[model samples]
Every structure is written in structure tokens, then in C-alpha cells.
Target: MSSLKPILLVEDNPRDLELTLAALEKCQLANDVIVARDGEEALSLLTHRDPGSGEFTLVPAVVLLDLKLPKVDGLEVLERMKGDPETRHVPIVMLTASREESDLVRSYQHGVNAFVVKPVNFRDFFQAIRDLGVFWAILNEPPVTTRRPPASTYAKGV
Candidate 1:
């Protein structure tokens, strides 16, 4: 289930981010949770290169992305990621406060692995995030990918 892989959390709201972090911590998952306050930062982290090895560093097993975001929206991020073979296999879960059916439909159409509506109740939201952490990070089996292929790989029709 790629337990060693990290979990990427892309959230713009500070309160939600804190709650999610706390919930994940309660889960006691061995996987590290990388936080990005916005979609742009999330994408940057995903494609960040290591200074030592010159390789991408944020190849996570699962990405918990928020629907509405600053700079690039969640749907745009989802589309870009899904369009790329390198990141296409990474499971993306839409964790948002939006209850719009259109948003859910759009998310699924864009290939989001799961969509979770954030609960208004603090306890409910905490438990939901904890459950997600346990399932996605511990129980769910993910594809094995050391690192995604470079952009050039796509250019040659790979």
C-alpha cells in the first residue's frame, strides 16, 4: 500500500488545515503528511527537484486536495495532474467544504479518486479526516512509482 510514501495535503483554509493535521496525527500513520496552502504550492511541491539528486521530491501516494483554491483551482490542478502520465496514477481525494453536486461531478469527471464533503461539526470533520488517513495511507493499495517520468517523456508520445 506504499506506506512509506508521503501524503500530500493541499488546503487554503488555515482552520481546516489545522483540523486535518490534527486528525491525521491522531491516526498515527507512519506516512508523512506534506502540507500546501494553495494549489500552486501543491503543484510546486509535487514537481520540486531535490538539490542533491536533481530529482522530484514530492512523489506522494495520495493527495488530499481542496476544491476551491487560490491561483490554480482544484479542478485545474486535477486536470493537469491527470493529463500527465507521471502523476496520473497518484490517487487524488477532493476534501472540501463544497457540497455542490456540480463540484462533485466535475471532480469525478476530472478523475479524482474520491470526494469528501467537509462536515460542519468539528468532531465529525475530525473523524472523517482520521478515517481517510487510515484508509488511504494504511489500507488502500497504491501503484508503485519511484518517480514520474520527465516532461520530455510525454513530448515524444510516450
Candidate 2:
């Protein structure tokens, strides 16, 4: 069987990204954390559209989405993910700097599995990421899909 797919991290801020990555690393969950600098890039990675190859199919274990992303923005990405049947079931946690009630309401409204407001303090940020990693990567049981049997099962005995 193929290895479990990586966890997608949709964040654009370099400093925040580094801190998040460090925190995840401390928890040892960073191994599968795939970083996307913006919402557009995040979408492309999730959709598996290789600009050169033209093939488009990717499904990750989870998506840690930042709300204030460039171009497409996080809410739009969340909307797209929830709207698409192929990608709808994947867990998405909204991570944002803003504590606006409107943003929180909209995030939950759009089907975000969790909403986390990133703290400006480094220690708090670290703790948040560690907790986030533990909850999503260790505690959560991701939705299951039926797997097909190997093609060899249909062949005659040697």
C-alpha cells in the first residue's frame, strides 16, 4: 500500500510558517507537513494539477488552512473544498491571526472542522501548533474509504 499522504499547511507568512513548522517538528508531525505559500498554490497542490504533467488528483490526510492567504484567500478555498464531492470529506482546520467574530462565524459556516487563532507570542504559537498536531494527527480518526483488492486476486493460480 502507498504511504499515508502528507498533511497540507496553507500559510504565506514566512516567520509564522517557520514557527509553525518548528512546533510541528517538535511534535514530530512535520514529516508529512506539505507547505503552500498561498491559497492558490494550496488549491493546486490539493487538486494535483502538475503544470507540466497536466494530471490532477491529490488527496491529503488533512488541510491546515490559513485564513489570510494571498490570491484565492482561505474562505474561498474552504468553500471550494466543501463544495467538491471528491475533496469534501477531508478534515480542514482554519488557522488565522484574526479573532473577528465574523471570520470565525464564516469559517464554521463554511465547514471548517476547527478554527484556531494563532497567538503572536512565540511560546503560545508553539504550544498551539503542538496541540494542533497532536489533535489532528494522533487523536482524530480520518474518514475512511473502501479500498479495492489487488489485481492479482483475479488471476489464476500458478
Per-candidate clashes come to 0, 0
In the range 1-99, model 2's lDDT, one tens digit per residue, is: 235556678898888888988888899763367788899988877676445545444566678899999999999999999998768888999999999
- After superposition, the stretches of candidate 2 with alpha carbons farther than 4 Å from their true spots are 49-57, 146-158
Scored by TM-score, the top model is 1
lDDT value, candidate 2, whole model: 0.79
Please provide, for model 1 over 49-149, each residue's C-alpha lDDT reduced to its tens digit, 9 standing for 90 to 100.
Answer: 76776777667768999999999999999999999887899999999999999999999999999999999999999999999999998899888776753
Local distance difference test scores for all models? 0.84, 0.79
Q: What lDDT score is found at residue 89 in candidate 1?
A: 93
- Pairs clashing in candidate 1? none
Error of 2 at 36 (Å): 0.7
Give the range of the ten consecutive residues with the poorest summed lDDT in model 1.
149-158
Residue 93 displacement in candidate 1 (angstroms)? 0.4
